[model samples]
Target: MSPALRRHAPLVLVALLVLYPLLPFLDWAVTAIFGVRLQLDRQIINVMIFAILALALNLQVGYAGLLQLGIAAFFAIGAYTTGILTVDKYPFQLGFAGALLCAPVVAGLFGLLLGAPTIRLRGDYLAIVTLGFGEMTRVVILNLENITDGPRGLNPIPEPVLPDWLRDGLDRFLPADRIDLAAIHWIVLAALVGLLILMKNLERSRAGRALVALREDELVSGCMGIDPARTKLTAFAGGAAIAGLAGALYATNLRTTAEPNTYDFSYSIMVLCCLIIGGLGSLRGVVLGALVLLSFDNLVSPLLTRALQEQLGHDSTSVFANFANWRWLIFGGALILMMRFRPGGLWPARKREVDPATKADA
Candidate 1:
């Protein structure tokens, strides 16, 4: 790459992401080349949502070195908060904007509630606690039929309202049938971009440094006057809030809260896998990992499986026709290979540089 191109690679990537939904012609091009229609808007939106989740998980697992196994609980909290506030069944009827504003706060509070007592736990014990918490949250939600509508989930959630000028501009590029989807795509994309900026800033903040110090050596961090409990709690709550935001976006996009079962251990593991595959402790790795993993799961697998099924005369019994079913096996092998070979990750975190003046003084 040219020097300028390399320097501005992030900006270029952002521009490409922003322009992706607007380029309807890519759908035609992809169809012509691949013989399968791509739901670019929906696919990208889903990827962005999971990307947000992975970023949130990265804040805990990657940044603070916390083993969080219950991120999905916070996710469920955010989605349900949005659903309860916006759904007509409840009187709040805060609409889409209200849900967006409130979901994170509610989720963050829950994060604090969970973290306050358990922040002292470490390693496998902490992971086990979080695992139990995740399962407990789902079970509680499942039993709350009166409040949550149980397995049926909440529905008819409010759709987002876009301003006329913005809508008009988008209408020019997107088909009328896809206007709403395009709007959602932009919303999720904006969230992803905003979160990335926030995370980048957080990494440079004093608190971020404290988290790193704590992650590296809790005893040393304590000797250096950093409160380990406070730092860990900050990471825990912040991660939960972000996950909540992701869940809200997911619910809005799907027009339902879905079921409590949706927020299970597997979801948390998937986000963790994204972080592991991408390179923990690196923001770029989080985004790249999310893109690679989510795109494969949402787009490539389904499309490839469908194509194979078609070729096999839609034979339900043929294993070749069910390529999508092998996702876990493929991911498992990928993880084993990654750990065996490139354990640092696809874009491993760079070591911090000591200041030249500090080094010289030392």
Candidate 2:
């Protein structure tokens, strides 16, 4: 590595570590500065959760080159699993810890089930099949009113238990009642950082190379004794597990799980959009994408909606009152512009090579 890069690496790592712990504090600072009493920490947590989701998607799309259109299915599975398990559901009272563990497992199992039959397919067909599967899962969740509560969703979801020492410390800072959201935020953030580190390591490992090779050319990978089907299945399962975990975290954070309608095709597409716009095959890119996209979705959209209503002197119930209808149009236009100018993405990953000859020459 270059001396400059090596010198700066530790500083970067330290900055990130400090920033993570102080994220809530920073949000509070911003709110205080603006005289706003918004739940800034909650918003930040939401974006971080989505970033984890995008990273999970990146594992399949960026690393493995899988065009998975039904990622929301796994996300829904995870969230619903957490909801059912942690909530006071009839005949079951698995605690938050169990729900946290089982959410990913159940989602992974579903991913395995979905991939087993379809991993043999490739390209557009695979995308279509996955899209259909995602839609099907949502439909099932919506229609299964008896189990899922359909459109009404599940409420009063239990909070995940924290270690006594940490919980007590947090209680000192925040009210005991409102500490759960903050706790969940930290938990999700830790999980995201861990997953990112793991994925980065995997990207530098032999398995990651095989995945990239398979992505580049299945025939060559097959010749090299890599089973395309198995590799793809593993990628799919891993990606699904990540999304599932995001879902579970999200449900816990929100303290509810809405109907299947919540995890619709648009949610999947928005995540895919983040991956593409942030930069394919790059973790940094996906994180950037998630932050930008979700920020717009949650913050900018509402602002725009209020602005439009005020400008037009229309009531809240005006036909153009909702900003969601125009969200796709704006997102689509941004995608088109990005594709036209920088198809690789906002932060395309550059290949690193260490040449011994160059080192000797230097």
lDDT of 1 by residue, 1-362 (tens): 99998989989877987777677778788778877677666777888899899999999989898999999999999999999999999999999988999999999999999999998997678888888999999999889999999998888787786789988987776787567776787889899999999988988999888998899899999999999998899899999999999989999999999989999998888888888899988888988898899888867898788778778874867765687788888888877888899876899988889999999999
Q: What is the C-alpha lDDT of each candidate?
A: 0.88, 0.84
RMSD versus native structure for model 1: 2.2
Candidate 2 C-alpha lDDT tens digits along 1-362: 89998878745853564355434576668777755455666777788889889988888888889899999999999999988887777557687788889999999999999889988886889899999999999999998999999898887788777788878877776666556665676688788788888988999898898999999999999999998898989999999999999999888888898667989898999999998899988887888898889778777777677678777774778656779677888788877987799877998887777698998898
Which residue pairs show collisions in model 1? none
TM-score of 1: 0.93
Clashes of 1: 0
Point out the worst 10-residue segment of candidate 2 by lDDT: 14-23
Candidates in order, TM-scores: namely 0.93, 0.88
- Give the distance in Å from residue 62's predicted Cα in candidate 2 to where it truly belongs: 1.2
